[model samples]
Target: MRSYLSVWRLPSAPVLLVAGFAGRLPSAMVPLALLLMVQQRTGSYAVAGLAAATYGLAMAGMAPVLGRLADRRTPRPVLLAQAAGYPLLLALLVAAVLGGAPTAVVLAASAAAGAATPLVSGVVRALWSRVDPEVRGTAFALDATATELVFVAGPTLVAALTVLAGPAWALGVSGVLAVAGALGVATSAAMRRWVPVPDGPRTSPFATVLTPGLPRVLLSGAALMLGFGALEVAVPAFAEAAGAPGASGLLLALWALGSVAGGLWFGARVVSVSLPRQYRWLLLGVTIGLAPLTAASSPWVLGALLFLGGTAIAPTLTVQNSLVGSIAPAHATTEAFTWLSTMATGASAVGAALGGALIEGPAGVTGSLLLAVAGAAVAVLVTLVPGRRPTRGRAPEPVAA
Candidate 1:
């Protein structure tokens, strides 16, 4: 195996880890905060889903642009700009909610915020690749596990602040954390120790999106994310419909709990599996896992099933990241990764709205949850296509070795 662990031995690893954690804090905070904010202010679960969807859509639409800028321009400046602007945007959003500005306005702002998303995943992943190749997998695994942990805490943190101070305070705190995180990373010497790698022609990012294998990965990831968006919407609706809406948090926590477990399990395995095969199996498993949710009846049942069904979440994500690295050219890795994030974010936004609508209508929460299953299925289906599942890159050494 190549020396992926070399980055850890580098003098700069400590700073990178700190910065990565700081940057990741916002990932967990944003969705939960947005959902809680809209839920509280509008008192409509569907509207809350819409807000969360809007935020995701923005991240999808804008990630590539920001990432492209990072590749061609300076990552530090991009990071700095996002660090400064994101907080202001959140403040505006908070004000709009407080002033009871119409839902349309809130949605628009949410979309803008989403679009202006800083491409955090792209940035961080790019940072890791600069580490020695032998350690990249371990580094990726470690980061993915940490991110799963963030999801576990991010929502809880937002919920607590909302209960204690108000959702407004939660939003404010996330913005502050994001700004601080971005600035901290951008300023760190380790953050600037980036190695430039591009996978495509020096063309517009639009051209980059058109790259062959890249789009398939993006679409597959998008489909999986769409399923996630549906679950995000359905859990809240399901809880409310069951006469225990407040238990939605517990349900989601259970889901994240499963993810944390899965991430831990995957992290411990030193596998040499092919990235595409890993993806195919992971997607299939995730879809199969979600099948049980279509029959969920109560909060307790939903929580239990969600936790069980969530077992594949982190593994699928880990494989997806590995595939992205395998396929993209060295120079454009960041941009490519950003494109995946963008696509997923967009798909998630739309999926959430679709799920919300389904729950609000006759299909109800049961049908809405089926959307998650469908999402997993789509990812599996994509892989089943001829020539869609080949391992890219130099083909990662057997992940099982």
Candidate 2:
């Protein structure tokens, strides 16, 4: 408690935490809201799914570019511009979908809306680099936990709003929240005081991706999320196979609940292990924990294993975030974080696709679970591979946290 309080007491911490949460609500809301809205209008799940995928791919593909812009120009103008643009784009999407626009126009609108999504997640994470070193781990843990909660809350809110009014209302509220939250983060004191690192040869667009010890970290993150993507599919399938399909949501929520508990516990304690070692051990823990799921015969058994395995999720992410802050070049901190987001998003999509195929094949649920375990094991292996040592004369300065 005191450890987390210490983080909250830092200057601008409250505003950053609050606004960051609000700004990111759209991330959780938009996919489902868009899916429901488009499905409601078009009466075609395939079209809805394609629109959602286009939106997500656009968001992931553009994040690194926006992050680079923020690194070069500071986050204030970038976030401010996004604040105005994202909602307008989303509004256009809603209008097009509701007004019986052509399929091509709707797809284009979805892509534009996603491309304009606020860069709040990466920017807030980079801002955490500014925190005092002593409690930075706890701050990252809290941020991870808050993010977990957002997914849980965002979906629930969308469901309620969709029932109360309609999918359009739910999406409209998402736009409103995005505008308000982005504006709040953009105008905050921390953002106002942040200075862009001066441009140099080391600060070039691709330089951050080439930083020492970063590629392995990014690979490890992508692998971890790949496992997560498989688990997301397998769990629901597990519940359906057990004759209680509705239990899937509850089971998954319990999994997230366990992660929240683990993150808080991990954050509050003092750790002596190096971040690299911690990352490896956490990956191993996830693999070990996930391996038992293949034996789960009922939703109760599967849910228990899920909750236990989930204890490693947020803690792993906390360590991963700390490693990025400690390993990324100071000149491109925001871009480094954005790359992490990009890798995770892209990898998770692949994992989901693979998991769906595995479930439909002879592999079935067991195969999907094995794929999840294999993904985590791959992350562990990536961590064991030696990373490039920093070159002489142009060594990057780690972000101060």
Compared with the true structure, all predictions reach lDDT values of 0.74, 0.86
Q: Which digits, one per residue and each the tens of the lDDT, describe model 1 over residues 26-61?
A: 777887788888887889988887787777767766
**Superposed Cα deviation of residue 181, candidate 1 (Å):** 1.8
Per-residue lDDT tens digits for candidate 2, residues 74-127, read: 888888898888888999999999999999999999999999988998988988
What are the per-model numbers of colliding residue pairs? 27, 1
**RMSD to true structure for each model, in Å:** 4.3, 2.2
Candidate 2 yields a Cα-based lDDT of 0.86
Model 1 whole-model lDDT (C-alpha atoms)? 0.74
The C-alpha stretches of model 1 lying farther than 4 A from their native spots are 1-10, 31-55, 99-112, 197-204, 387-401
**Candidate 2 residue 210 C-alpha distance from true site, Å:** 2.0
